[model samples]
Target: MEYLIPFNRPFLTGKENEFVNEVFRTRNLSGNGPFTKKSQAFFENRFGFGKCLLTTSCTDALEMAAILIDIKPGDEVIVPSYTFVSSANPFILRGAKIVFIDSKNNHPSLDENQIESLITKKTKAIVVVHYAGTACNMELVMSIAAKYKLYVIEDAAQAIANNYSFSDKSKKFLGSFGHLATFSFHETKNISSGEGGLLVINDKTLVERAEIIWEKGTNRNAFFKGIVDKYNWVDVGSSFLPSELIAALLYSQLQSLDEIQKKRIAIWNQYKNGLKEWALLNDVEISYIPEYSGNNAHIFYLIFNTSEKRDNLILKLKNKGILSVFHYLSLHKSPYYKDKHDGRELVNSDRYSDCLLRLPLFVDLTEKEVTHIINIIVN
Candidate 1:
């Protein structure tokens, strides 16, 4: 069924075609070409990340993080239940036990306060997802990881340009806080390369090994750089790198990040202002951005009072030629993991699973379209 307003439309900067043409002219189509280098350099220079590697998708990036951390059988990695399966799949594939945590009461971010109690002798890492491009409490998360000597892998798939401000008046990008982090450039994300992702290495120790893993577990990258006489397989990995075409497309999007963010934030503010009274009256909750975190306006979701009401709203929007949708079901309660899950109930994660509704939000969505959505919701 087609709708006048779709749930999402991928936005393209006018320069994408030109950049791809440049890649063609250069005759380097595979990964780690000039375009890939430029793309990696952009993130590393802008965010001061130790190293960055473009991957086929965020899942691949997370997989690289898992490999870098050496997750083995019986190792437990704590993660929020209310997130995309990619967050947990990587570690699970390494035979690590995923200790699912609950979301915060007011936001979809993992509850940082409950993290310590979940840590056991088997715990090796804490993976945190910055939902809707907002920052999780990195200070608390990092302190806990430090105390326990655990690795922190941030699933910053939705948080590309988002930043976190500290009490010292310093600011850090969301992906920069973790020892390893991942970012997505899927069509649904703030930035798009059709399908692409980035792996950020903040812990300098992982940089060399990450490069090797990114190059199909070989020392090929070092060989190309004249550091190694001959490249050979030294570690376990897969083909995770994106082709140069994807990097070219992504670099084009990165060039327009500021303009895209400006439009999105404006749309977000309009929704907030328009629906404030209605949300209050209806007892619905809007997406919450903490003071320390900078909003990139990646997503604008509403938490309805009940699942029935939420479902009704989706149907109503559909009837009106609009498209709104819901996000992740609790992974702990997922069919594949339900029986495997321990008997502990994650209250907030379940609540979000039942009630959170994501409205149409994209760089191309106009104010008129946004107002139309708000009118349907408020009325």
Candidate 2:
């Protein structure tokens, strides 16, 4: 059924076509062209990140990370089972065993406290997802990684512009905390191209090697730099780069990021304020951002008292020409992995799986449309 209000509608900043036209004028349609380099450099300089490699999708970035860390059979990687499949798949594909952790009782972020207990001699890395663009407790994660000599991969797919705060009253962007991190520019994300992703390398040691892996296991990037007379296949990798056109489109969105963020945050506030009273009276909980996290307003979701209540609300909203939706099913219990799972009960992961609902959120959603959604859900 077509609804008056849908769950999501991708927003455009009006400069996308002009940039694409420039790419055409230059006649470079392949990856790592002028637009691609400019976009990569923009992210590096703006975020203070080390070498950045643009990819076709966040999944590709994560896959590159798995290869970089040399994940292999019998190796274990710790990750939250509450996240999307991409968070775990890359490592799993590399023959690494996934050690799924539960979410914290308060938020969907990984229960960092449970991480150490999951680590073993076979543990190679910890993949942490900053769910809903909220920051995870990086201090604890980093300290633990240091203690065990493990790699930390921040699956910052939803955390493009969010910051992680420290007790010293200083802040670091979410993707910068881990040795390696990934970000998404999918249409549903805060800033987007049609489909794009970035791999951020912070270890410095990994920078040179990452380029080789990014260039389809070749030294082409080095050869182009005149660092080598000719390039050859040097390691394992793939064609992860997006076309110059995609980069051009993404660069246009990045230009207006601050303005887009302003509108999104305003819409997010409208939802929170509009529903706060009703949520309390009805015994429901809206999305919560901890003080240590910066809000990017990436998504607005609610946790109902029970799965039944959540399902009922969705049906009621649907009847009123509105579309509300649920999020990921707990991966540990998924049919594909249940037999392989160690069978530890991930209570909070299951709780979120059954009871959480995501509401309409996008840059183009008007106050009137938001009000209509709020009023329908309130009643």
Candidate 3:
């Protein structure tokens, strides 16, 4: 089952071991240690995010957002169907009804135009997933949220280092627009801490409570800072913080973010150029970066004309000792949610479910390996 080229190989910044050794020397192994603080501060300073907290996983961060937003039973939350389950699961756990939206005609991002019609009196929030690191139209999204007085959460799990440019060419980081945002550092992401995530609080009013929730629903952080005489449980929360070891590993990659992004975008361009002609002849659509979004090269995929063709390409790559794979299926059609879904059909989401194929892409993947993958596809 092994392949010469796999879908992903986590890249290390060479300083990871050095950082881990420093953690050991300091002997502060729990969460919120020096390493954790440094990693959190890096995001806040670099991206201008209001406040940051590292979590055990992106799911935990989303859960924290749900709590902060106070999602209640029967409240409806609009979300795109073309995404991983984590995008919607957090709100569902809070007893909210998920009103699934369709992907845009030419892009996998949720259609911003269709959002308003779907909002109802029960609607409480909108969850936007920046699929393959492309930002959804934040200007329109924020305007709609403002009009409806709804919460907006950016699920930036695949979008670290991505920037969204407005029409005027002013740029803002992907996770900075939403009232709340979350990120992932899974091995497959641009950054890796083995498994880690972050919650960004753009609403300063929520900063104090977010810190409390991140610290197991206690006022312990305030107590340590001498703001409170004694810490006690004051809110509903969980043990969301990841240990210092995860932060140490994550901070090492933060220092190398610029280099990692430059290399990835270069590789992405190579695939686009090499496959341009063959893809046209074969009617295979290579991925496109939206005008408003800068490429972070989080994924490079092809959309075949049919499901059979997509499946065949996977087998062909496998036969040649390479590995390629598909991404999220329509969550509205998922087994657990299928019957629960209203009868509306999401055409683009379903098409992507069947035809989109993600090729092998990672920092460690060499040029020779990439050319081999392209040649196989074009052949």
Instruction: Give the candidates in order of lDDT, highest first.
Output: 3, 1, 2
* Pairs with steric clashes in candidate 2: none
Model 2, 1-379: lDDT tens digits are 9988889888899998999999999899999998888888988898888889999999999999999999999999998999999999999999999999999988987899999899999999999999999999999999999999999999999998889889988998989889999999998899899799999999899989899999999999999999999999999989999999999999999999999999999999999999999999999989999989999999899998799999999999999988899999999999899999998999999999999999999988999999999988887
Report the poorest 10 consecutive residues by lDDT, candidate 1: 43-52
What TM-score would each prediction reach against the true structure?
0.99, 0.99, 0.99
Segments of candidate 2 deviating more than 4 angstroms: none
* lDDT of predicted model 2: 0.93
Candidate 2: Cα lDDT at 249: 93
**Which of 2 and 3 is ahead in lDDT?**
3
lDDT of each: 0.94, 0.93, 0.94
Tens-digit per-residue lDDT, 1-379, candidate 3: 9889989999999999999999899998999999899999999999989899999999999999999999999999999999999999999999999999999978888999999999999999999999999889999999999999999999999999999998889999999999999999999999999999999999999999999999889998899899999999999889999999999999999999999998898889999999989999999889888899988999999998899999999999999999999999999999999999998999999999999999998998899889989888887
Model 1 per-residue lDDT tens digits across residues 1-379? 9989999999989999899999899889999998899999999998888799999999999999999999999999999999999999999999999999999999999999999999999999999999999999999999999999999999999998889999988998889989999999999999999999999999998999999999889999999999999999998888999999999999999999899999999999998999989999989998899989999999999998799999999999999999999999999999999998997999999999899999999888889999989998888
Cα-lDDT of candidate 1: 0.94
Model 1 residue 207 distance off true place after TM-score fit, in angstroms = 0.8
